[model samples]
Target: MYSYDVKVLPKNTSLWGGVGIEKAISSNSLLICRNDELGVSLKLFTKNQDDGAVPFGTLAPGETYIFRLNEVTLIGAKTTDDVSDSMVRCTIVCPQSN
Candidate 1:
């Protein structure tokens, strides 16, 4: 098991910019949580950025989301507010390597 904090920047109105988690090379599960101290909402995406479409989901402050996958996958995140930065905690769980 491993965990880290990811910083998410504000996105422009015309461009969808976000951060991606690609470190879980062999992980089977992923957990993400928005920082309770932040006031901005966190948006989550699977695989790639949704460009101009709506995000896969949105997490309020102190809220959490989970993803189950059979292989490595990219997780994307950004803030709903266009002027403030936000953060999320990511935890990855992988099977034991023999």
Candidate 2:
């Protein structure tokens, strides 16, 4: 496995999973993880929403969220600070084939 950067700037950004690359995120601040699809094991969701939308549960200043997937998946997030260059940097673990 290998690691790379996926940044969530002041605006929004989408992270898509694939067979070649596996994503595992460790953020320096609060980072959101949203999935549009339902019943995916790695997805986070809230009790009030039936659409299976949820946060990655407040990834503190130094926390990592590991995702396990066998198929392609899509998700998005942004930093809470909203600074000019506010970024939520995630290190994506990619397989050798990637």
Candidate 3:
């Protein structure tokens, strides 16, 4: 009943690609899956493509981070910024399947 998340359909979102319906999820905490912080998979893109990169090992309060969709695939990453009702959303701009 709080927040929500959804599987980005078609797997890619470009200017002319496609889009997935924004689902609601209650959990917003991000996951860092490596030793180096910047080498993370989950990412939040702001203006100028600034990385809302998730920190490794720990989830900081008021900070943004992300969870990888898998080992190789970084697209359709799970975002933690969508945790609260007031926090901003982190959407992944994937390539088109076709």
Candidate number that wins on lDDT, 2 or 3: 2
- Can you tell me which runs of candidate 3 are displaced by over 4 Å? 1-56, 72-98
By summed lDDT, the worst window of 10 consecutive residues in model 2 runs over: 39-48
How well does candidate 1 match the true structure in TM-score terms?
A: 0.63
User: How well is each residue in 3-97 modelled by candidate 3, as lDDT tens digits?
Assistant: 23333222121111113323222233333322122222233221112232223333223445545322211223333444421222344333335
Model 2 ranges with Cα > 4 A deviation: 18-54, 84-98
- TM-score for all predictions? 0.63, 0.43, 0.20
lDDT of 1 at 56: 73
Ranking by lDDT: 1, 2, 3
Best by lDDT: 1
The candidate that wins on TM-score is 1
Q: Rate residue 98 of model 2 by lDDT.
A: 30
